[model samples]
Target: MGCIASKPPIDFSADVNFEHFKLLRSVGRGAFGKVCIVLKRDTKKLYAMKYMNKEKCLQKRAIRNVFNERKILESLQHQFIVNLWFAFQDEEDLFFVVDLMLGGDLRYHAQRSGAFSEDRIRLYTAELMMALVYIHDRNIIHRDIKPDNILMDENGHVHLADFNVAASIRKGSLLYARAGTKPYMAPEILNKSGYNQSADWWSLGVCMYELLRGKHPFRGGTTEEMLEMIQSAPIKYPTTWSEPCISFLSGLLERDVTKRMTITSENVQEVLKHPFLASLDYDKLINKELVPSFVPDKDKVNCDAMYELEEMMLEDNPLHKKKQRLQKTTMSKQEQAKRETIGAELQRIAEKFTVYDRSKVKSTPDVALDTNIDDDEITSASPRPQRASGLAVFSNEHDSSHMSEDENALRGDSDSRRVRSQSTDPDPLELPTRLVTPVVDDGSSTSSPIQA
Candidate 1:
């Protein structure tokens, strides 16, 4: 008998339009857009579709950052990094369909589970180190590396997400733009000293510390006090931590960039060889052979806070704000050509993915049924349904007020809290709107680099 070949998994692609997917309940919301769980009609595959309004992005002058993020994501392919399955645009919005990380973000898990054991922290730290190594090798700096951006999958493995502020660097060059969540930011970044990939190492150290101790290493009631503490306070380790673990953190949290572990090409290898990560096999770790100590309950994909917020939002009437149609204005001939060039590049990238068969998709109904239920009539809480067919229509309005409230509530006073400060730069186009709020502590002037 002849040998038979197993068929490869089908990769379905669709047009750069929202019509192809049935939007479900909102999973998350950001400053300019909302993330929804969308099911592809033709293949029934689920994805977390990040929909950003074109007008809002334009108003905020964040279009460049959006394009840059798309470019970076398209080029990256790694197990520990969030995979961008598709990038498309319609007249009204830009859509990024990515892998649905059902296990939620590390911040949610850390808050729910409390302090993690050394063994568990070691596993997560090792995995994140591998992710950092991958990105640093390509001369890419993930300016933002915090608990919220580290998403866990069903198997308890974590992948780095949120590349909105990531920048590609040339060899031996340093980035001066201050960007990243405040608490996780390194001294060099906070001081506005030109920094490099070593900054991410500092962030990883902060994450490890928080996971083990349940609080940030540098603590203060205000942002200024926090920055002062970061610059001067000695990194105090818990009495329970072993000497090796303390040494490992000390290496990464070095205030002087020159002495920082993983600061140089040669030092990165040395950092990995430290006693704290002795149990991890670098090869196996990168290959994801090491099993995690904690796996989130698969049935509860959304955390309690997220689930509750989703329920509340779904019950409320969808925002009645009229959709703002975008129109090009005050564009010079040169600028117009530049926009066209970028558009063509994005279109080309979109076409590289698998093409979907649109004929199989069902037609949209004239009057979609409103699924919102009255809050008083609520009874048993059911699992989020995976609809076999039919679109769950909802408003695509960008509700900034609701999003701000949700973010504040989800992020308590722990190390994971993201505080915002006014932007120093007046030019909105030069930086994204999210970057305007410098991630910092309560009521202090110290601001972290805004996400560009």
Candidate 2:
């Protein structure tokens, strides 16, 4: 088997401006945002750009979740996970540039093919399990693992997408966050008992069951009824299924967390040793040497519903009218005061320091400073004002001695100077205090995890 070469490392320091990319067409939509197929003007590279309205995200109290998702995506590098190339934010929106998977998600392909064969299911399960192992090893839990979140690349390789609800926990710690789709949620999560990484195994079981049976093992019409069904219902397996297949499902779908296979990093090997997965060479599978049993049609678009929704959403997008109503839609009195305070502090800092662009400097004779002349008229060429050893531009007013060399290198002097200008003031980008209560429990129901 040939070893699959790893992708080149992405330049995390690269500052991407949204203006450099042109939106070709809408591809998908979610709770707080929409995704579009965008083309980079300079590189002509295609990427799926996810844009979220800042105001809407704030209203939903999902700001923390958004930040977490970005942090996790930036840190991860796996073949079976969607890679984040760039992340940036503007006044109105947050943007993420990720690899474009034209093959769409597993749910779309599943719907098109009806029930998948056991061999195909085994291949997908093995690939996804590898992804889970990689993340879980790092103490990250992908809370949602439904078919919709599992995307396929052009070569029919499955990649886990969407980390909005994922959480990272300390070793041996349990998370109490009640998030994820009801159908794929583990018994511990549904019961509001704290859950750990083992919960993802439960979701994988549900996903595998759906793929083989063409429906969820446990089903109900309402959320409450679904919760009850998950807790009480016995998972029925078709008599046609082999004993090894039934054993694998039983182990993963175990309600008791302690009894479940692959509860912690130490037990992951046990999952790989299951009889149903005996045919797979774990090393070759992880290295991408094993040929996939099925491959998606590269010429045909896999998801028509996503494109249709995007078309409808782009027509009435509120962001398009932001500039037109900028004057009319003014901030509240409190927000206005905060902005003024921030602006005043910035102005004061700007008056004290001047930043010189190195590239713009010209060879000219230095002029002696005359105390009688106005200081503004003559731009004193004083020995290029010796660039501060640490890229610090502000003279005597701000102290950047605490900043590390790596931090200084990542931030351009111009941007760093601007940030230092407002250092005395409170964060201007802080989310406003909302009247709505934050969701700490299961009372605040989120949208179904199923992709449209």
Candidate 3:
């Protein structure tokens, strides 16, 4: 009898790597990296691909935040939050494929579009509260909830994005990291008192107020002056605003945690029944049956065109360039030696990151909620050590127990310790002052020639 013939194993390797997608356009950028709209070759599905350079991450001391962000997102799936679909790493960068919000961020809309109607703001509030209820149930807090972090879809539905600074709090525990932007931060966070999930409620109230007023509730010339406003300033609602609107805002912005309205599993109905959202249909809202008042123009790519221009003109290594060089980057002998040392250091601190695919997992990922890295502002008061060469590496000997408080309380670990100093009021005088693509080859440019 003739020997039976068998097919060799199908190579599924390319499905998860950089080669799997075609770069469509550059959308937006964050402190860590830039996001691109990419089309998956095999599935023909579009996604927002966020790529962060490993070198830049280490240099910025953001690897921990990146790692924690990935772990937190892996376990989360929400309608009102950006959902992660795939995560993988190349030789040079870490990549995340997430739901694409083509309508752009709220910051973009707030600037170009005229003042938002109160009815529309009410709809948005109901949607976001549902999201808050979901995340808080799982013990996670979205520390950043400003207009910049809120994104809109083609149909004008908003989803919260950017988790680099998000924290996971254990039950009954408090978050101490100084991790939010100015003005949007709650009084407790500004005060340096250990804050619970109520902090998120405060931020939401600020957003509700800002969307209607076209300005932040707390304002000053500098962050210092603004922080003072956050601590002691009364939330003054305009006389033109409705009485219910003021009541909803006051409930959320209440300085007392006990009185501050929070959304949780136990209180979901209570939040939905708020006077601001009394008539909202919870089922219709979650099902997206309620028509949004402001729908983005489907014909336009809602992101800033400047991002695409920047990718084409100024990127050191553009996406198309990376596409051509599919082989692993060849490291010099000296660089290889450095990587060897860095590799061991990373292994000791954290496990190797894996390429995660949702289709393969039968259940939620086993990623731990704990970030392991010290987020206590006191521990990080001294900025991560930097080197003149721009290749700063985290020391393998970092000991959390040996940090000494700086004598400068305003800018040092002292800001982090005020919560425990038995002070009821926030320090009034305190304020801490703190990727690319594309190209058009102009004859004036000295950049490497772009190959089609």
Candidate 4:
């Protein structure tokens, strides 16, 4: 038997191991293992514990990949990438304790909103570019970049997670794996001889296309159909997309791998210099000004007092009588249920029409449909499904809240209320407009650093 070894705690030293961690619920599941919400008993810290059965993983020869992932997680630290706290092994399983992304994945949001706004896409793309720049600079190719892998935080900032297929590069290492999401894959990656970091950029471009237009650029029914379409997919610009967005993504989605726009590459710099992100200042962007364009619904964010103020205003409005009348006339329970059932049926039918290349991009794994696990296994640890009912998780707090809420909301107890009357209606528009970075003065001369 392979004995399970546990290590001392990093910060709060209370001897804990796989068995010691409280298993709240299964957040996700797959072929290899399952991800469950676990609580560190002594510290009371919550984490998504990914459990991979060593025997099952070794059978697939994916242990090397798991090892590589652990190595990569240990070496990197960046705002746009998910943080891996620790890796440990037990007799039967390899456990990865990771930061929880309560906000869920981008694919969930994309499905809900029909399509993300151009502004929203810009913000997400910018974060992805920064993460890629950091990843590539360290000679690691993520090999997977898609909406499903991009996890959101309470603040709406995107973190690139899922390094299961990531590879570290050397001078002559072979990169094989006709892997990655089919529609998001670069043509070169599909060939699978080997691909450099440029593949991530091409994928990013595809992600942007989908974010702005609500569908992938290259799509079809079967995997073969998708590969064929991807090979012949045009760089057609949608009329609905903004001019700046179209131009920037066109450069990114170039068929030539060598010419693909990367974050640090000159072509990428040229794309960022475009008018679409003209107001974007990288230094400020990182520090939080020019924040993410798409904030989660305010109801999803915890703005305890701010919401109360809004309610008070609504109560005082002259149209309060009309509002009450409208509420009363709204669909009754039976009618509402009927409408929901019909809507769900229509959505299911529509999904059949919206096909994509299924080059078999990985998800948590094929989950057990039965058993105690729910579809949203990732949230099994939660007390309940937190309905989106607060301020944007990513919005700057006007009033002080000691601890941030869950992925979709923050909870705080404070008596003060900020004036809610002066802001824009949609929560996205109500974000603070201050710039995080100072503008560089063109006339001011500075000394260029001398090379030693």
Best by TM-score: 3
Cα lDDT tens digits, model 1, 30-140, are 544556556665566777777676545544534444555666666666798886776666644677888877677877666656677898888888778777887787667
lDDT tens digits by residue: candidate 3, 1-452: 89989745434554487767766667777757778777665676778889887766665667766776887888888899898899988766889999988777776666555347788888888888878777777777877787768888889898888877677777787765556554667888767677878999999988888778766677665556667888888788899988888998999889888888877878777777877788888889998788888998775666544334565557776665674454556867987786775665344333456787876767764333664454332122236532221211123122111111222111211111000001122223321110122322223424222110
Steric collisions counted per model: 4, 0, 4, 17
Report model 2's TM-score to 2 decimal places: 0.67
Best by lDDT: 3
- Name the lDDT value of residue 220 in candidate 4: 57
Q: Write the per-residue lDDT of candidate 2 for residues 240-312, one digit (tens) a residue.
A: 8889888998989999988987744465556667889888887888888788889876544455432233233
Candidate lDDT scores, in order, read 0.60, 0.61, 0.67, 0.54
Rank the models by lDDT, top first: 3, 2, 1, 4
TM-scores, all candidates, are 0.67, 0.67, 0.77, 0.60
Higher-ranked by TM-score: 3 or 4: 3
